[model samples]
Target: MSTVPKRFEILLVSEHVEDRGGASVEDSAVRSAVVEATGRHGASGYPIYEGHGIVADIDPETRTVEALLVDGRELDYGLTALVRTAARG
Candidate 1:
């Protein structure tokens, strides 16, 4: 594959979600924006360096992050960007 898939197997989702951490990852507002951004805009291809957001030296307000996705031999441009962006504050 060329992109890190946004795939979540049925079993994984059920298990992971149930094992929620101390709190939620995104609030209603940010979550909504994310859904619209990726769901509607089809925006992807944000590069991730270390483990932080895609673009370095950004502020906590940056909600989105960009990173290189590696699923075996696959690269997911959209997933990479999504992961990094979401990682930001």
Candidate 2:
């Protein structure tokens, strides 16, 4: 058995996701959703997503997600609330 963290909600303010793709995701825009695999979530300090500024590169891992920007930044935060807000608006 593997020790993986439970699936959590996050803000995927990018165009690409792990498995599913949708219309809500736009260029440089932020979309709220829930992800399972750890690679989909990155550590703290990285900017979640910018409005067509830095290149959002997401590196997926087994138990963690590493995100890098064109300027070399990171995004780490619990995006549950953001997702809820974005979906409503």
* Predictions in order: lDDT: 0.25, 0.36
Residue ranges of candidate 2 with Cα displaced over 4 Å: 12-29, 38-64, 68-89
TM-score, every prediction = 0.18, 0.23
* Model 2 C-alpha lDDT versus the unseen true structure: 0.36
- Put down candidate 2 lDDT per residue, 1-89, tens digits, no spaces: 64433343344453346643454443334543443333433355322432332333232222223443433444434321122212322
Candidate 1 accuracy as lDDT:
0.25
lDDT of 1 by residue, 1-89 (tens): 34432211110012124444565433211211211122221224332232211122111234343222222233332222222233233
Score candidate 2 by TM-score against the native.
Answer: 0.23
Which residue runs of candidate 1 sit more than 4 Å off their true CA positions?
A: 1-15, 26-68, 75-81, 84-89
